[model samples]
Target: MPDLVAIASPGRRRQIIIRSAASCSPLGGALARAGILVLPAPPPGRREGSPAGEGTTNMGLQPPQGSCRGGVPWGAWGTVCTALCCADGLVYALGGMGPDTAPQAQVRVYEPRQDCWLSLPSMPTPCYGASTFLHGNKIYVLGGRQGKLPVTAFEAFDLEARTWTRHPSLPSRRAFAGCAMAEGSVFSLGGLQQPGPHNFYSRPHFVNTVETFDLEHGSWTKLPRGLRMRDKRADFVVGALGGHIVAVGGLGNQPCPLGSAEGFSLARRRWEVLPTMPTARCSCSSLQAGPRLFVIGGVAQGPSQAVEALCLRDGV
Candidate 1:
């Protein structure tokens, strides 16, 4: 089962493993058992060899280690459905549902230098189940639930202006969707939808629609079938890697969480199946720290403190 390490890579560890396997090591057998056929290491004084269309790195298989309190502070109550982003060397914890089951518009920023979270101006719309992505000096909040149904409202918070401005709304409303910014565009991926009369899709099924918004053009276009995600997932973690958009661990057609993952190659315009997450959970938070992507804190059987990451590259 130890060999399953390759199969059970959470996020950051998988990235490290993919890059760290530059040369053959004693771990070859275990990796082989995991179904990974590693290429022989490059000769000394030579560049490392990797899969075709892949780049070289110098990372290791070491996993991320550390923990922080889940709760924000005495005055700031903790809640689910939160979104996070980094700007100007600070982390922003965005809107989420409060204990009353009402979506909150509160915005809080964490200062590492001060080791505390401070409040910012509230969002124009109170939302839950929304996904956030940073582009330039602004933070874009995508589709999320306003009440029992999904919301199409799209808005951006300008870091420099300290204000929220309405942006083009989503063509189709969705909640709990996975989102990421790559190549000057914002992608809104799969999530759950409410069934309505006259609609063909029934039972509140998961959506496979993939839409991308051009930041410069201010337009949204749905990706073709060939470019869609391999899996229909909601509440999953998503991040940009090697110019690819990777989706990991979320709810699917099953009752339990999914451990599966996939990545969309910008170069090839195809979805590549990646290793499944070590754990499966919903409503978890994902963030990019430098070249690594992290999934932290969510519900599996119950509240979870588990933290996982993927180094997008070997050296960086």
Candidate 2:
């Protein structure tokens, strides 16, 4: 497990302490007894506002933390290949397709501390299967299918500047690709580039190619192959635990999604399969919050809201 460290911003005097494993501190015990933590503020902060302050009337409670856990409510609907972005102390969920049939442009922000969700302006392009990465305060949404065909267009949303700008299109149209932001570049991995609405079990093949776009150079370069399977999504997470970028469950061109999980060694330029997920899924979302990786909604034989946790002890 990685060591816990507290990062404090000099200007705001606010701090965030992350631990590899949840602590059993006094605060944690108190929170567990209460069953809920109440941090009173002005009805939670909005995405388009200044940093919230700690006021006397506003009390923040620290919940009893524990290692990650997983459980799924069977029959739950509304699953899509969504991107999760974390910036400025909040996590923002970007574009995805839901049960509505049409791609969603809606952006939702969640504040874990406040246990609340805030809806923000939708993306200019309503798209599903797109991937998102953060460069400083800006968030970039890359290739995914739009309308009827996979698109290569790219757009970025600046959190600090509060504006959206169009970037150059990807070299090719791809969806369900693995995406990771590292060393100032967004690395996109293999995905399907079908031209029509194909279900998960469709025979569309997965590409083994790896391509990366340099933020500074404004150019894309295809990297050497690391894995040969198709439909395997990349990165699918943020932050590094166990000194690796974890890629979770995805399907190949095979009839069903694969339970296999893998991690990329950025320094080594190699891939290592981790412990397989309890379930096989594709088009799912994986989030790295603190030390655990949460594998959220995705499609198996059908859409699933099944949530699972991947721990370091179980992987490379």
Candidate 3:
């Protein structure tokens, strides 16, 4: 297998597509068999009309074109289970456990125009299974695990300011939870609090809790009902689309991950089921980009690179 890298110039836009061959390596072959396509990096120039003016530029060594998923390559080694978010056309990748099971603290940002990755200051604490979202010009990171230890600490990164600020802790410690931002508030739901590192996967203790933080009020509130209502599933991806908050995929005590997807309508105060994904996965990252919902890189029986795209208009 060739080490591939793709670089985009400061103001250029590129389309990246991943092609998998049957004879390719296990990872590549599996991806191709799954019918997944990685998206190219975001277009350059601060994503036109972004609230944050001319955001930061890419700073890392450029990988070869077509080597990474879509146009963005996983930095250095493939960092699966990492948290990702996009603000002002810049994509930010946060901590995840490496192949060695040790948590990584490196933070990398991608500039779509340049099609390059840049290094940023590391998180104060290393975390995996962390939930992240972007609001205004800031990226908010919430509860995750440090080697099986659930965390309640919350932090925010200011893109324009280029700094991180610690926020009030979550009401309860959690890891592998789903988080999303809507109407200037952050909603977190469904995660696990393992007893110890050795006991992490022994019995998956899932929560059905739902909590929200009002950015403007700087306070937290318990929602009317827990996310599950009765289902005991951990949520993987939480995102906002057209005034609705969607939660997709997670463990449900079944042998396989779930293809179930549900959404909360902020306008209606009700939960509705959307179209199920083609495959079942958990611990994946999801983002809404230009009228499409992209769910990327999750775990089924094992880590998967299956990327599924859904159109919001098709739902209603």
lDDT of 1 by residue, 1-316 (tens): 0011122222211211111221224444644565433333222221122222343243222111211233223233244556555555566667877767898888876544443456677888888767776777788888778677787888999988889998888887666787888889888888886665477566677877799999899999988887888888887888888667888888889889888878888877788877677778766655454566766656677766566676665321
Candidate 2 residues lying further than 4 Å off, grouped into runs, are 1-84, 89-124, 195-203, 226-241, 301-306, 313-316
- Angstrom error of the Cα, residue 172, model 3: value is 1.5
Best by lDDT: 1
Which portions of model 3 miss their true places by more than 4 Å?
Answer: 1-80, 98-100, 111-118, 195-204, 226-230, 296-307, 313-316
Question: Model-by-model lDDT, in order?
Answer: 0.65, 0.54, 0.62
Model 3 lDDT tens row, 118-183: 677778777776777666677787887777678787898888887888887888666667777778
Which sequence of candidate numbers ranks them by lDDT, best first?
Answer: 1, 3, 2
Candidate 1: minimum summed lDDT over ten consecutive residues — where?
A: 1-10
Clashes per model (N, Cα, C within 3 A): 4, 1, 9
All candidates' TM-scores?
Answer: 0.69, 0.60, 0.66
